[model samples]
Target: MSSVATASSGVSTPNDTRAGASTPWRRVIFGAGVGNALEWYDWSVYAVFAPFFAQQFFDATNAVSAMLSTLAVFAVGFVMRPLGGIFFGWFADRLGRQRAMVVSMAVTALGSLFIAVAPTYPSVGLVASALLLFARLAQGFGIGGEIGASYTYLAEAAPARRRGLWSSSMYVAVTIGVLLATVQAAALQGVLTDEQMTAWGWRIPFALGAVLGIYAFYLRRGLPETTAFSNARDTPEPEKQSMLRGIWENRIAVLRVVGLTVGGTVLFYTWAIGATNYAITVKGIDPDGALWAGVIANLVYIAALPVWGAVSDRWGRKTNLVIFSVGLGALSFPLNWLIQGSVWQLGLAMSVALVVHAAVASILPAMFAEMFPARVRASGMALPYSIAVAVAGGTAPYLRTYLAEAGMPSAFTWYTILLLAVGLVVIASMPETKGKKLE
Candidate 1:
């Protein structure tokens, strides 16, 4: 197996060369890392500031209502992701991945800037919330497209046998972004009173994200497109199918990707978002303590991602998915039951659970990309994944809160387990894509 790196001009296609000869693995990983870090930095800022933003932007008569409103707006962002994915994915396939990346990052930066400068409800009333909504939607659209383009570009540019190792950088960057958000939230909580947080401290992270977004844009400006896309474009253009038509044709693959995504995204929100709330509201831990727990657990998961990806490269993508599904399904309920006593204990349980999820997250890009040809791979992968994210991931935190309020906190655990079991069934039906060529 061989791979090549396409220069940014959209004209030069370099032949496959070793890490020492062409663009080094370090450079490839750095570019992918910076872009992914910025992407998740924007996302993590929203999750971290949800409670505070709720107070500032929505009617904050009750704690529950505020949190619920925040999550509702968060869900709205996921709804726009697929549209961004389709538009940018098609653009990437047509114009070039480098161009697609530049546009996505630029849009996300603008969105973050909008959120940073937006007024509070007291000043602008409904229009304040409206501006926040538009910003989130814009960020959602950019993120929806960014991941597919970055993943495909990195995976295709890597050494074939070690693609898993190289591609794992994406999740590592995501974990770092999550960690940054957690730490920033913790730091703000330490310095500011709750009143101050609700007043203005909450905007700091968004402001920081806008700065990071600018840095990411400059980094991405130098990134080359992937050779696979270049070669595909050099050949005669395939009949450009409508997004809906492509989804209809690839229904089975779409279902499989959705199934896989549901488990991964659910676990992500449960650990990253729901767990933080659980620590504060249920376990009586301080907000800073809860943020620290997430930071530690995510750091551990980030360290583990590449190892799992390499294991999948050797063992098979299906094997990794099966293990992830079964392990997470059996363990989620037990872990949730055990997370009440100590912050350390909660962090340990969350770390263990997320390791199972890392197995899936680490290799999903390659697996999804392999499921379809280049013609529709971006839309095919992005739409189903985003839809599942909106339905499952976007709802996990809110649903968990509702279940807790209904005096059935355990029900949330059962729900996640059931989703993992369903994902296992879906993985069973899909063929193993280990070592498959990206045809």
Candidate 2:
């Protein structure tokens, strides 16, 4: 347990010299990434299989209406995320990062497990929907805390110089989780007929999530509480304020974090999740093809995130975010149009859009975490971030579908672009956080 004294500030920072050249930062990144992946995997299974689940759960004449119902449930899950953020953020700050992570995963695992085993609409009528909603709420609760805890844990663990690279692992894991769900859908589609898919194939992904979540749980068990959290707890008076009070004091920082999160979440859903639905329902691509395209594009995103993160570390967080916002705004409409082209064209469009998305997603964890001090870091970062994500990103797919059904497909794209523009403005106004030590 060697330590380094900050030359400028004279504050002691823990140096991971226990295993020379063997970066503990890597472990921190992997643990946080894995946990986030599991959380996203559990939630994403619902999105990827929404059409099938909608049909199974709700009886509606229009396919869009049924799908809307499914997405509404998905949105409900996100709406609960802020509460999750507050609860788990406080718990992480008070109890320990590892303990908070374990609790979050347990809640998510239980939710996915419930969804995997729940009876269908035919068997249980409204009760089935009630159960599904309850499950999603539970998962949302876990996720609310999961993200902030994971982000703060990784940011605090990494060296200041490499925080961008390490934090990018969170988005890398997110894309990986998305890839896993798409692959699962593709694999399940191969084995089951349309009839079987609607009947039972849809449940397989949820089941898989439960299994994978259990594995993640086991892996996370061995992770240590972050040194920052430990130090915060050990530090004397005035530093020991409640998480809520700290959040109140840092309201402006929370708003800035939320503003940055809005564009990323919206564009992410628009290109990744919403695009999959649009490709299948509007553009007439086969469900399997759409699923495969999503999988491929996500793979590209996962590969590209670390590169962008490293660049951000070298350049600046605000610069990378501005680039991402501008690129995404310029390319979004065209990408949607391209999805209506040939399958190869659709794949190309998605890949490019996601690569652009990688710029913001890669650096967001570090960017947001750097905005607040450690004592209230998790709550300040998680609450507003989750709120923006819930309102903007979570609602994008459903809103886009609704507008499209009302004969305004282009409106959805415009709406996304507007949000991106606002995000860019926010980024322009904010300071670059690169190399800033989290105190």
Candidate 3:
């Protein structure tokens, strides 16, 4: 951010490059943000369109069961996240961060394209469902790799004092992606007939996701390697570069990442994704209403991200994490119960929930990155965080649906509360790294 010049038109563009720096910090943030956006944007596309996908992929059995079955396939992506993290984390650790992102983006694009072109259940039978699962697994692998690499990139590239503000781009861009998915789904519901949406209209969003993934690849390829990564390249012994060896050496830091992420992912998925599904299935709100609620809440969430990050910069990361854990644990049950019926009810509930979660989402990348040195940063961040997402965030919708269908919706609420309590304990036990320079 030193001596950066801006446009005469009063708005800077990506073309505005630094005169002497290797790469402008703004450009680095933009490139990293774009990759994060594509990852979560594709993720929300599936969540927003789950109902349409369920109809197209399964025979007309019990409607709820079919949707749950589809979500189980959706969980397949989550199931692969830990493995993807292991692979991609090592790939990033060995190769450059930019190179890892380019390949990850392609995996997402190909997977999305596969889904966009998949046939209906009647046309291809169980094979259609299999294709859907394959797509999710591919996307899962892509995004799993995406989070650790991208987060490490941002944390490494930013200036020391402003790291939290820069890393907040992760959630700022991700929330924009979430909002786009909801807006696209809402527009489709409003513009298309139900039959049209169920038949072919549902494919438009996935096709668009494919296109964004390609663009993300190009953006990432242009990014220069982080200074930290470049400097640390020759320091580690050859065998230490093996991800398993690094993870073993930094096992404590990795476990802390997992613990910190468990409550945050549960809150994020529950509010950002699970709430939409609940609004439609449990409360019987129309698709349009649920989607619109998602859109509004996500818009608000995007704006709140950097604000929360700034707060964490002053108040401390552990403080924000504690607030997030307590708020979600205390509020989820009542807020979810109050989210029945009207659009205002659902929208208001999600917006409030998002306010609490934005703190965690904004501060998390910086917090995790602060835990380890550049050599093990990517894998240390990825593996533990991915495991938490798989266990808490990925299966949240299915678990909520399943529990509700089994006539025990409150059970899901209690389960979430239990996890948040565990996260709170971890937060209390963790070292506060506010303003601490990355190793």
What do the candidate models score in CA lDDT, each in turn? 0.77, 0.79, 0.80
lDDT against true structure, model 2: 0.79
Model 3 Cα shift for residue 119 (angstroms)? 5.3
Minimal lDDT window, size 10, model 2: 1-10
**Per-candidate alpha-carbon RMSD to the true structure:** 3.7, 4.4, 4.2
Q: lDDT score, residue 117, model 1?
A: 89
Candidate 1 wrongly placed segments (more than 4 Å) = 1-21, 50-71, 121-126, 193-199, 238-243
Q: How big is the positional error of residue 397 in model 2, measured in Å on the Cα after superposition? A: 1.7
Ranking by lDDT: 3, 2, 1
TM-score of 2: 0.88
- 112 in model 3: Cα distance from truth in Å? 1.3
Candidate 2: pairs in clash? 85-144
Per-residue lDDT tens digits for candidate 3, residues 1-439, read: 4122321123433432211145666777778888678777787788768887797888756679879988888778888888889888988887867778788888989999999999988898889888898888998898889878888888776655566777788888888887788778778988999899888988999999888887877877887777667656767565356677778888888888877777778778778877877888988988777877888888888888888888888888887888888888889877988877989999999999999888888887789988887788888899988888888777677788889999998998898788888787778777888766554
Cα shift from native, residue 334, model 1 (Å) = 2.4
RMSD (CA, angstroms), candidate 1: 3.7
Better of 1 and 2 by lDDT: 2
Off by over 4 Å in 3: 1-22, 50-70, 118-131, 236-241, 284-287, 401-410
Candidate 2 residues lying further than 4 Å off, grouped into runs, are 1-25, 50-72, 119-127
lDDT value, residue 224 of candidate 3: 75
The clash number for model 3 is 0
Error of 2 at 76 (Å): 2.4
